[model samples]
Target: MTAFVLVSGMFTGTHVWRETAARLTAAGAEAHTVALTGLDGPCTAPAGGIDLETHIADVLTVIDSVGTAQDREVVLVGHDYGIHPALGAADRRAERVGRVVHLDSGMPQDGVPALAAVPDRSLRARLAAAGGRADTGDVLKPPAGADEWRLWGSTAGVPDATLDRLTALAAPQPLATLLQPLSLTGAVATVPTTGVLCTRNGASIETVQMMVGFGDPALQALTDPRVTFFELPTGHWPMLSAPAELTDVLLRAAAGEGHRLVPADAAVPPAHLRPFPLDVPEALRERHGNVDLHLPDADGPRPAVLFVHGGPVPADARPTPRDWPTLTGYARLAAAGGAVGAVVDHRLHDLSDYERAAADVAAAVEAVRADPAVDADRVALWFFSGAGLITTDWLAAPPRWLRCLAATYPVLAPLPAWGLSGSRFHPARAVADAGDLPLVLTRVGLEAPEIAATVEEFLAAAEDAGADVEVVDVPHGHHAFEGVDPTDETREAVQRAMRAVLDRVGRHGAP
Candidate 1:
């Protein structure tokens, strides 16, 4: 068995390659994920020093670097539009190119420029399926969960209606490649080839049409005696939504078995189902430009709860933290109390944008309002630790969608306490004017006997400012409400706090 060389398609980098590579490595084969040239953009090379040939050369370079020392044969896989470089690498290397697997990709044709292999991309096709009438070009937006948001600005915790609008705005792929034919004569016939198709309800009709085009007699030289064909029971992106199932199929393909028609096993069950509001779209976990913002995983509109991490955290801290409340203990509480949830992120530090952070929360709230699952009118905010102070300031002026606010172990009166000017960026004055706003404050005992008294004083201050307030105590824990899981005691405390706040805001039961 040869070392497996995996290549991701056009417009994508090695970010999504981890799962397939990991699975193959676990099965005992050396796996490598190759990054193409030009697409990665040259920061030092005067902007655009690379070309298509340079990219093909890059694939060859990866093979020579790793394949020479490992295996003579390779079970090469190409995803999306990556087939072009994969075939060219195979055609050039000749000996090292063993098996070429086109995973949900366009087939190559001889005498055609690389760009001609692209599939047909019409805004009309996408719009026809999405039930919209917009014309988008190039910037293929992620399907909206519920709003008018750019793909870069989208968070998974968005509401459904907003998602519908955003999804309708998805752009068309470049037709440059679709109009060209790929040259695969030299090494394609000698190598084993396979094609796996990804399909979904929202997928363009041309996907299957492209697959048929390659199988046509005019493309005979591109045919393979060892040609294996497969169709995935999923949309164009089975990888993202169904990684585990998709991984198994990818593994079978790499091992020369993907062409076979065996069903893949399902993904393992998640650990819990707590309910937490996740409508915020801040940068929860970010790696450079690859930020994974949160959105309410609920069906309709939620008030959209935005939670910011303390200063900045590393990207590797995944499962997004927001899921802890949404999938773990929060579910039990939400079921007992009947409240939709969400969590969101903002642009991270260094790359931080204060104006965008404020806008992101507001946009997320707007998205939550557009969702059918969440009650837009009952939107709120929950802040923890520094976030308590940050959100207090956020809610002070509050986005137009914000209806109520709740903070745990809040940082009361930061300007006066921290010696910062009101004009300074520390705390926005949203807290002071969170006018006639319904509020819930959760404080842990044992920090200071006077902390509760301080909360009472803050309540008095809020009352003076005409804000409604309710204070709840969770014993045996200090600040930040440590160990505040939804256990029986914790549940009662949360419920009591909820009932009081809802009563003040005049909201009860489901909406």
Candidate 2:
């Protein structure tokens, strides 16, 4: 039966949680420390990727286990940036939770990512002082050791590998969630909870202040009750720096003396499927004339459907796939010939200049047309998601490639982010500001009204620009389409997209 939930602080995980969990168990409380995705593994370089909400859901998963196993709810705890997930977890699993303990964690009273709460002076200095390795290009990774991290200041030591692990393991968290005002009116804070602050480091003073703000505003500002705030002289990690003392404090928590509250309803999915390994190829280089050719056998001749991959993320990554049989990237290749397959490697949004990105796609098209194996005349263009920007520009500004366009819930509207939403003439703006185009475009047909609206706008605009557009209503407007390929319905839609393109290829077959 579940008894206690021992959450770790930011930058650390169940590995650090081991000492605490063991002590709790020795005292007769069943304890489990949730190891969230990205944390358990290395992280992607500072290129900016990682999902905060999902980490919160992972905490919920541990608490939820109590529903099926224990009659009594578990005591939840959060540390450092860990406060975000811990609070979020409790919010989603209130019924299964008895109390929440914020162990010197930063709370987001104002929709800010915990990263913002982590002492900025410390991070900036570390980034400036330490030079990272080559692969990530200017992306700063965490210091390797505890001492090294101490030198870095702000955070505890996490590995350089953590970044690599995070890139593949973590998804890009929408900055909006971090920026959205937090409302715990009905959740964890109202429940039994406590805040245990370790005032050992001057580095965390700012973070602790932010943590105080996360509590109920009345207590935070006017007058207050309902929270037990404890301060210890130990440094960042009480469990490691001072385990026995931390144990005593936690035992008090086991007795239910202090714990603030948690909002009920934050469920973070724990682990995502592992990412397929990426091996960047030599010939895979982008050349001129919009060359988009697939190797049926890697050793085979020309192929069908050439995908123009997008930028920002590595061309390869896709949402975790529910269907394992069909490998990603190779999907279009699989569908080629009579099968209908294509591989798209998108331009790097932050890296490439305007002309260079468009030139890359243009080269891909030219090469694909020149390929002996493919019926250059019959070749098709498949753009995935935001990739429509480059594809659109290629089709709009330059000479046209073959016929037809297939977009899977491609992004249509400008970002809803404050500074992000604008009529600026950048990538998103280009698509939003385009002229008449061709062929069909499918926005996602999901239950989410927002996604539906966005897809509709993309289709409407594409149509206005002269492109034939179709909006396929995916049963549920979930992101499941990218990964869950096992479903027959999903398969059918994919076939339809390819078929439409194929028919278009037949008509617009190579010039």
Candidate 3:
């Protein structure tokens, strides 16, 4: 049996951990719940008087008071606001705490407070006003109407009676707890961490990565290779809402089962890549502007493939490329082929934004290279359909890290819609600037009429320009045939192209 220290967030005590702890204890693991002072019963401290150190001490005391404190493996689990104290304790007792599970809570980074990390200004303001220590005295009640089941919505799968009990047993939390800044060094990060995301809250490892755009240290923790991410399809309080499911997740996390979630077969994509965050606006969350990494099994640094999905014209009901059946299927195929697959998202609406689209692809490349599992020196780019137009700039001035580029049914010429009238896009002109960069062009016989002339012209120009270009004629294939139909021939062609790329990079076999 394992041991777990369960910590609760604000407005609640060990009571909030009742359901989860019971389940853990039933599984033969010793579960200890820490209840901070002045949170449950009567209190003397002013609204902002209860500092974070006090809570940290509470958690530490529990850590020591438990049976044979150091006799067994221990995992400290923090939910919501409780993460602060748990973090401090983990830092102070780094050797003893084997793993820290952050359950749907924001990880306060160095020099950043929990409240300040929140991106939503209005929500931040509301939390501040509700519990501002200077204004509210020592403690603040749960936000008005927030305790009701409706506030939690459909995500809270718990019964009405459970919700009522939770609301009734809630206590006032110290404002200082929310406002306090965490003090952390490299030690806390050294402790293995797992992020248990609650799906309904629009919080996931991916969302945290997206939020990292604002330079939030808290969200940056998700990038740690030692960190594992899990998703529970419930509201913020899964302990009460979905005890059994949450319990299983907790057990698996304790057992270090996260790495198994992403299999070489690419059977099931993790939840982080599945649902789109609800908080982001549709325009900002457009399916075309996202990027994801699909890693294959690796013993060390391995060759990587950067894939650009086709479709130059944007569609209204466009699904996220990560969720698209064809794109993800291709990613799985790449994994099976023994290369780290990276799928990139870019603006497909305004043809003029091709430069920005190129940047998105570059960003994905950088992100993939950042992974220790990928070989920084060897990476290939595979462009599909109209997306091939975005790679002309890369061909013109190739980076040393890029080995080769492969295109399938590409649009090699710029259209009027691309807004390049004065400086029209032309890969034929860039062929001379390609500078020995290996290229493979796969042209389909049933290609779109609008781009046929340009493809033919570019092929002729490349032959004369002394550029090393290999052309593969898929006579029966159409634009996006692999994604749409994925005929046996198309699959074989893709496999051959990838193998050729690996052979060029000298990394063909699996490690």
Ordered from best to worst lDDT, the candidate numbers read 3, 2, 1
Q: Global lDDT for candidate 2?
A: 0.49
Worst 10 residues of 3 by lDDT: 277-286
Model 1 misses residue 187 by how many Å?
2.3
Q: How well does candidate 2 score on lDDT at residue 323? A: 19
Question: Model 3 over residues 134-209: C-alpha lDDT tens digits?
Answer: 5424555553333332332223566777766666777776766767778887688789888898755544443344
Ordered list by TM-score, greatest first = 3, 2, 1
Which candidate number would show the highest TM-score if scored against the true structure?
3
Encode model 1's per-residue lDDT on 173-202: one tens digit a residue: 223332234556566568877777654311
Separate clash counts for every candidate = 57, 77, 3
Backbone clash tally (model 2): 77
Model 3: CA > 4 A from native: 41-48, 67-70, 117-120, 126-136, 144-155, 204-225, 259-511
lDDT of 2 by residue, 1-511 (tens): 3377776644445766666778777877787788765555444432334356666777777777656555665878777666777777777666667777777554455354554454434453343344232122233344445434443222222344543432344322223223323434456556666667665443222223322322323334211235555655555566665666677777786565543433211242211122222221222322233233334434333335665543333233333121111234334333442423444333543322324555666666666666665555455566654455455464445334455555565544432211113222133334443343345554445423333445566555555565445555456433335343335565556556656766665522232
Every model's TM-score? 0.38, 0.39, 0.49
